[model samples]
Target: MVEAVSRNSFKAYDIRGKVPLELNSTVAYRLGRAYTELFQAKKVAVGRDVRHSSPELVKALTEGLLDGGCDVIDIGLCGTEQIYFATFHWQLDGGIMITASHNPQGYNGMKLVRANARPISGDSGLRELEERVVTSAFAEPVGAHRGNVQVCEVMPDYVQHLLSYVDIAAMRPLKVVVNAGNGCAGPVIDALERYLPFSFVKIHHEPDGEFPNGIPNPLLPENRDATAQAVRKHGADVGIAWDGDFDRCFLFDENGDFIEGYYLVGFLAQAFLGRFPGAKIVHDPRLTLNTIEITRQLGGVPVQSKTGHAFIKERMRLEDAIYGGEMSAHHYFRDFAYCDSGMIPWLLVLDIMSREGKTLSELVQERIDRYPCSGEINRRVSSPQVVLESVEKAYAPGGQIDRTDGISVEYANWRFNLRMSNTEPLIRLNVETRGDRKLLQRKTEELLVIIDGFA
Candidate 1:
């Protein structure tokens, strides 16, 4: 039986835990068998990130898939999205990427998806996989029917697919800064270089499993300074940095100013709507005044989706939205099989700058001036639910309240979304003001006081 402690790794979306203790070869092997049996998958694509334990995890996972009587397509060391692309592109039944993805070097885990690059979440298949992994649900297969393993490198086609999103000929020769954060993004960037004209200033580009510099989580303010400094030193047009597995990207302007991911929703929606008029756009409920107003101004419908990828993707297909953006740096495109790509957002920003004859700052500066935000503040408390209720009671009377994904309270000039994280024991908050940075700061401080009192 799989250890009861191992189930801690099975989160609302994917698997993640410390290596050799909560997750290891045995857990991966059982997960592989469970995924195969749950989907009755005939063929599965697999890939891995730069984590030290990834190779061993992939090996054991593949063995389990083979023993489950499934054919395996190993796509070699790659980012999480590579497996997503291969699963849909090669018409495989499912896929898994061995990655801890922005976690510390001591951790390792898996990201799984069904055919067509659709996610398998806790409600969908992850819960079942967890139970099976613990119970060893499926019996062993015969040797003759064991699956065969094949290796296929699919980066060429993936690059072409990314480039197809823009008019490459119209792209200007601009100095670009790419901070891979020493994850799996370097190889993909090198592959993409052959097709593009931009000169890249690479930092932390090499894939080192040890992560000597630091864990490659760009969302942390501490992790962002290096990229911002690189942008300033080189006088580049823009700087882009990705997390460990390169699924989400953060951007900085020419002046080394970090652009809030919330503002990008409006900017990208405007860019896409200019071409596909009246197309729908999906946004999370965390911060909405800027997005809703921008979509309306651009003559596009705005749909609010739950804060997770699986929820957003499902909602996108239902609404036929052209794009979706979360404040956490996840940008989903309709053309990219309704999947989020760290690579696509920067490329689109480059295209926007080129086509409009503007710098990255010029493109998003106005949005910043119009709606300044308190970029996702996280606080650990004794009781998250009680804190949430306290904050809601304090402000819900004067503001319009939304409980879509979290408790979002909207007032005339300012708004905030306060909720507990799905995977962590903490209360997360995001506050924004309509062209009033002072108001944003004051409200955020006031809310923090009420929340801290509960804790």
Candidate 2:
């Protein structure tokens, strides 16, 4: 079934494709052999999300790993970060997670990491692995090798690791709505609830691959209403929603308001900077001013990196950054092997609110107002590169331009970033200004007009 599978399954960041067609047991098996051979790995950790196809993929992959003389530590039914945790926390040679992560059901994927949970993306060994998986002659069948496979539970240790981030002694009682969206997050939330003091109103808490309420991507407008409504319905202090694999989480304020990830990056930057004065913090180039301004306000250094987890993590390590945040809700902590963690972000926010006795909105509202931003807007175009070029040319007369990750043109009061998608024929635009929401809106519209005309 996997012989004719599309190479599109091998993405820029990870391997993701629709089940049984583009991705299946045979493909997973081939990938396993290739990964083990490429890394020359002897011992590795394997984890799987709650997708129905995950079990077969996991088994097939493990079989191939075993055939390649690699012993597998299977942390069964885990989120992407759990495998990351196991690989780093246990000092294993490598790890792979079977998950599509917020994609629609019937879609499945894998995320790979080397020791210390360092990401293995396209530019960093994924391409080589892709070639190996296709061209190399993989080894013998499932039971043909002598390598060992062990089933282990790392939840207790993982929860303990999460608890290590904060003191937790001064934490206040806060009613929070946790919407797991029927993914792997439910179990982690349940585990944390037993140790933490907050009252949780759990919604869609099952680890169901059927995904009765639809895929768990909270970034989608349709998916967010449930979490917002739950926050309102429960009269909770905040709402938390996660994707299918729970690597990224979204937040909602007490008034059923969805908090944009961009603002949260600034908020977390401040929190970390306050604690570790003059610490380095890394942010993506898509939206810059708020993060840069806030980090500087507290005598901390703000470094901008190209977008994507692998790139961000690499930069954070290079600078010894205390934290890194993508405006897309993926937060990384220095204490967490410089890898991204969705669970730690919400926990840190709660700790911050409890310490300050301020609402979630109160902590971020000022920053959001000062730098009102046009949250990312994606427009499909026939020639996304042409549209980007046209926008760059139009804005070139006045604003300073940067090609860090995309086309970012800046003025004193307002700026906008236009980046074409790596996997799709779409240009994503983000506009922002200094306390000028109207300017943000107007600039966004002006760019859209240019983009539309080009289209």
Candidate 2 stretches greater than 4 Å from native? 1-5, 139-145
lDDT of each: 0.89, 0.90
The TM-scores, one per candidate, come to: 0.98, 0.98
* Least accurate 10 contiguous residues by lDDT in model 2: 137-146
lDDT of 1 by residue, 1-455 (tens): 44453687888999999889889888888888888888899899999999889899999999999998899999998988888889888888988999999987688888989988988997779998998898875675789989999999889989988898888898998898999988999999999997888999999999989887799998899999999999999999999999999999999999988888888888888889998999999999998888999898889999999899999999998998999999999999988778889998888889988888999888888888888999999998888988988888889998988999779999889989998998877999999999998998899999989877765
Q: Give Cα distance to truth, residue 390, candidate 1, Å.
A: 0.5
Cα lDDT tens digits for candidate 2, 1-455: 23453676999999999988888888898888898889988889999998899999999999888888899999999898899999989999999999999887788999999989899998999999888776776655466455799999999999999998766888999999998889999999989988898999999998999998888998888889998988888899999999988889999999989999999898899888878999999999888899999899899999999999999999999999999999988899888889889899999899999999999989888888999988889899999888988888889888898898889999989988889898899889888999997887888888899998855
Tell me model 1's lDDT, rounded to 2 decimals. 0.89
